[model samples]
Target: MRHLIRAEWTKMRTVPGWPIALLLAVLATIGLGVFTAAGNHSSCGGATTVCPPPTTGPDGAAVDDHFYFVHRSLDGDGSITVRLTSMSGQRRLPDAVPGVRRVDTGLVPWAKAGVMIKDGTRPGASYAAVMATGTHGVRLQYDFTHDVAGSASRIGPGSPRWLRLVRTGRRITGYESPDGHRWISVGSTSLHGLPARVQIGLFAASPGALHVARADLGGSIETIRYSSTTARFDHVALEGAAAGGWRRTDVGATIDPDGSVHHPGAARASAGRYTVTGVGDIAPRVDGMAVEKTLSGLLVALLIMIVVAAGFVAAEYRTGLIRTTLATDPRPGRVLAAKAVVIAGATFAAGLAATAATLPIGTHVLRDNGNTVLPVSLLTDLRVVVGTGMLLALIAVLVLALAALLRRSSGAIAAGVALVLVPRILATTSVFPDDVARWLLRLTPAAGFAIQQSIPTYPQVTAHLVPQSGYYPLSPWAGLAVTAGWAVLALVLAVVALRRRDA
Candidate 1:
């Protein structure tokens, strides 16, 4: 096995064009990535003062983190209960143009004000809350993105609702009540590693944009401005050892008499009652969209890889080198396996270098161009970089298998590129309907592109989650697996051909 692999490696390196192709792969990947990132600029001018600084979600996507919070740090297990007397907000509707249709004016359904327990005040920190929403009634939400609806109940001056959040160690339970006495459990979640000292608070927030579908236009549209929500809390009570000596601090936006964008109204407390008004989202915005844009160069890199890999094996058959090589090895399958290993290794090395170089340089370009880049954990970034390399290596192997079966560089390269790249191009363009594009990506080898997807489609967020919009129908790893399956099937057929037919 070792000798076979060494012989294959020697053959690959001796071909000068093979090395040049790998180098081109590296350059193409990094060059395209940097260009894309540099060209894309943030709408906010890269200033937190003008717009909320870009924040990350638990899943590592970038988001807008602007809201109003009144909180106190607690030292241990505790509970906070408050009665929400009213929830109301002014809805800003877009003006009607002479030709353009007028958008409706109404509160976003998820706009909320509630009692919350947080790991800390940082934008992406884990936390949970029980809130009264603008139109969705009550909800128990946790992390920076998960939400669960509770019983529907109207909240106003006459119809008051009670919310209680109990923290016992790492577990937090939410309960709702029509009157202050009879409690019904909304939901329970564990905030892993919730510190002894955590923030317990009252908060209010709404998204910067509301996604609405326009049937006449045949797609979705976003609201031009945000709507603010206000809620009055009374009978505020705390329990357990850490609940005493409370203090208040605003979490995201501040109160300004001048009525600036950064001002989310104010929180006022008097005689055990509190009134808080705020705008902006408490949840993280999906960062995967940015990642897709930054890494758009991967398509070009993969095309270069496909051509190089197909030519590598087809050249052997073209020059009748395969017969001589197999004459020495006799076992044809071993020769094919050795060729796969050699191509996969070279592809992986080149891809890893390209991706590693692309991310930081590309991210820097994005920031310099006034775009916000979402931050992910070091582990997640590592996975993305390494995963990209693995994806390229597998693609090379898949192409090699196709070449082995077809024995013609043109035939194999044409088929492989069509199978992988064509669908992606069509899906991203307006040439096809969004549904057809999504299905092509989902069912074809192009699904492998999901491996690069970093943003998630949140149920709570309103956006088109199709391939054209940078959202993959499949999860990252699942999409890779589908490509792998195709590669394995092709390799099996290639091995059978090698064993039964004359090389």
Candidate 2:
């Protein structure tokens, strides 16, 4: 087992052009991350990189980059002043009316840096403060240091009053340690009324800092020891439920509106505050935008990667190296597997590189357009990007299979290009309706690019418009599946041809 793993790992790591592949993967991952993290603003606004104070867009809607801002209390909440340094290079200002674009400092106490989520949202509201008794608005007296301005900022060394949330109804005695377990809490917050967005990190005062290194957010995979239904493991990979009917293995609690779940061992939540990371993808709190972009890019990037796959197998066939491969491996199936594995890995890694490289550029565009709403799970988004690259490797497999079956480099290249590229061109023209185009797009790279359509708010290359045309070209997963199906069908044909043809 050890030897097999080591051999595979070595081969996976040490391919001739592997370094370039890994570099590409990292670049693509980061690039996509920064782009989506900053909110793909170029798909958004004008010359402004980040939304300026009291800023409004051409759509007559004012855009704010920052989300949370509570006002200081009028009486008991005391006086609190919070200053935000512009890390986005430019900033967004808030306003009372959505269409009225004037940025007035007198209206917003925190200048152009605040957004009000209080009173179910009052006009021209900004700033957060913890009010003392007898106060109506949110406010905290005094200010902290703004010394730590970058991603790294340190708070405290004063009164370490922290807010913690905990579950006791039937969680796996779950506990999380932050900052490498330094600031540990076992039983923190008690579940109560109303769902809340509980977050712990850095807040700024005149003296406060934002020292953030490893923002570790983990969901417990508990053993389901009890349940209300016949627990099944065939649907998923689970180890925690070995001794019991453990309800939540990935997320916290899942319940139907009837106050029940697929099982009875399900845990309950406090208030309406859903445990997003603990729960499945119920909301945008855990966005897969980066994943969407990565997958879409992978579909496009795979078109480029087919060239590499062809170079390896098709060009080699042209140069007669494939005969040498047969001389060494003999078995067509084994050789095919080896080549496919190498190609898939290389393409996946290269996709990652593309994602990372695009980060700085994407970030610039996002901030310029004023869309800086980053999700909590940035790393997960990176994984999606990496997956897209892997999808390209699948594309390579199809290309390699065609190369082996035909044993003609030029013919295989032409077929591969036709399979991947032509549909995108067709989709962009007035050739088909949106849905019709989507189904037909499966014939080209556009199908795969559909993975990047996380939101319905993506551009349409198709000329004719429909009801949901502006939303998503195709669902991301569905698009990937379509592309995968094409690759698989091609591979199956290649296998059949290889088995029958004389080497």
Candidate 3:
């Protein structure tokens, strides 16, 4: 092993431009960190207000926008009648917050006549809405609807409008289009209680400028598909109408307006916190996994180290160099062992260097994003984190053994990619309930992330929650273990293959 380490190191050190690459990696990492530590980096697109925006800022500085498109689920017995006039949201600020004042960007030029949007509250609805004009609209508005000053706009070509309404956590998507396949995205959105039949359409005042086209509503995905492929509200969806295309029903209820009863107004009268059990998420979205990137890059450096070792091992095999190497060292196993050592030492050094280089850059990136990994970081918990990194390099050694066993670069890379890529792809869907997805995802090469998870089983809701999904989703640690297990299994397979196969 020591001989192998020496041989590998000698080969890597002699390689042209190798040192430069290592230097660049280290410099980039620390430079980014220093930059981030010096600058102000907050959440994207929003001004860097403190932790929370102040409630009583200068006038017009605060704007709370709630756009609503209301509807009622229709019964098979009758046309589904619905209204849309008002929408509002709780101020998202510090605990002791108060509203500054009210403002309105009332009814657009396109909405149908007689329907005016104003401050009104609907019983059971969470938000105060601005809906159709007049007495009927007032009758529907709940008390909270008053003083919810906000502007409204129709889905238009100019506005690039799209409506995404979420009522009781269920999302609805709708669009207008002359062609069924091509659809327009809606702009005004509403958050009503569950079992809502949200009525939305395009209308005009004075002389009708807009014309009706078509409308349809399912869950969210279908609506998105329609809009992505077409224009906005060109199909002519009206906000308040007796016989429109959209409606919501009880979970198990049939789409047809059978004898099922319609839900009362859109809000919950006395609100309670809602929780959905077994709907867990696997977070730490890929973008945030900086340490994971470090591990990967280090592993790459390690792989290059392995290739260096293998090159020495094959020196005799290449251009009669192995013959001369064997003649000089004489002991086949001992010579091979020495080569392995050189490779391991060099690779581990390179790996460590790569890791050290990334740390500063990763720190800066996180800081610039106004986010920091917490509870722990790689520096504080180097054992587990470094262990993961070393494990990756060891994987490289095992692969190098196979390369020595195979002696062909194309064969090695092909075999490696073939083994690793599919598994990683499958693992992304690891949270899926399908048995195959679970079995397949767990068997990926990059399984170390299981340890990095901040939370186990992050709260994730499913698009469709059916009973027969599969073996339950694994906890984050368990999921990571699944990946590690695959790695161990692969190493074992390589070991056994090496022992059995001829070089």
Candidate 4:
């Protein structure tokens, strides 16, 4: 086996075009990635203030941490209770006349209001809350990503809801009640290191309203309109070491040039009743430019890899070198295996170098250009870089297998490229319906591209999660498995054919 692999490696290096093709693949990957990242730029805040990076939650994930908070300091073990009497929201609509914006009473489904216990006033602080949502009824959420359903009934003036949060050391428990008398446990979780002093508050928040429409040309157009939510809370009580009076803060509120809050949330207090209005969400960030957008040239790199791999095997057959190879090994299966290993190894190495360089360089360029790249975990980034290398390697192996079966370069290369690229193009270009597009991504080799997805589709957040938007139908590893399956099947067929047919 070692001798066979060494012989195959010698053949690859001696062929000048093969080596050049692989080099070109690497260059294409880096060149296109850097070019795309540099080309895309944004004028964030008109150069006065560059866009801030997304708020990172306690778990190190990017999160939306904006809301209206009316909090007071609490030391030691404590609990806060509030009765949400009403929930209302408004959405900005298209102007009826020039310079005249119109607004309508409405609510995005995820609008929230109730009691909260947070580590501090800072955005992305560790916290927990029990809230009444616009349409999801009552919910208990903590650390931005975790959510638990409390009730399915809606909140209104006629149907007020009572929410409570109790803190004991690092542990926090949430409960909901219909009449503030009978309570049901909603959920409980422990903050890894809860501080002795924390902020207990009543809060309100709403995410942007989204409208998606089918375009005449193709695909879908999504518009996110400004929206805000307001909630009235009364019968507020805090059971613990209560400090001074309540303090109001619009966490993550935008500031205008005059140093005034833009689209600011408000907290009003009167006779122990509070009305809080807030804009923005408190959840995992599901919208933004993903880090993988830099790797836009991967398709071009894959094409080069496929061509090189197919030609490597087909050239041997064309020049009648296969007979000598098999004559030395006397085992056709081993010879084919050697060729597959050589091509897979070469492509994987080149791809790894290209992607490893592209990700960081492209990310830096994007950040420099005032674009906010969504933050991902170090593990996820490593997976993307390594997964891309494996993806390219498997594709090269699949192409080599096809070349072995067909004994021709052009046919095999064409089949391999079409099998991978066509499905992706069709799915992303909206030539087919979204359902059909999802199926294409699910079953085709193009599914391997899911390995590049740095942002995941979150069920708690709403957005346009389609192929065109870079969201795949399958998980990253699962999609790679689909590609691997195809490669294994092709390799098996190629080995059988090589063993049975005359070389």
Question: Which candidate number maximizes lDDT?
Answer: 4
lDDT agreement with native, every candidate? 0.79, 0.38, 0.34, 0.89
Model 4 per-residue lDDT tens digits across residues 310-382: 9989998999988888899888888888998999999999899989999999999888888878889899999
Ranking by TM-score: 4, 1, 2, 3
Candidate 2 lDDT over 58-117, as tens digits, reads: 221222222222121121111111111121111123335877553211111121111111
The per-candidate count of clashes, in order, stands at 4, 75, 63, 0
* Cα lDDT, model 4, residue 179: 94
Q: Report the lDDT tens digits of candidate 1 across residue range 210-243.
A: 5444433333333445577778999988786664
What is the Cα-based lDDT of residue 245 in candidate 3?
36
Give the poorly placed runs of model 3, Cα more than 4 Å off.
1-8, 17-47, 51-316, 328-331, 371-384, 429-437, 448-503
TM-scores across all candidates?
Answer: 0.82, 0.45, 0.40, 0.93
In candidate 1 the C-alpha lDDT for residue 281 amounts to 75
Better of 2 and 3 by lDDT: 2
Candidate scoring better on lDDT of 1 and 4: 4
How far residue 248's Cα lies from its native spot in candidate 3, in Å, is: 34
Residue 414, model 4: lDDT of: 90
- Candidate ordering by lDDT (highest first): 4, 1, 2, 3
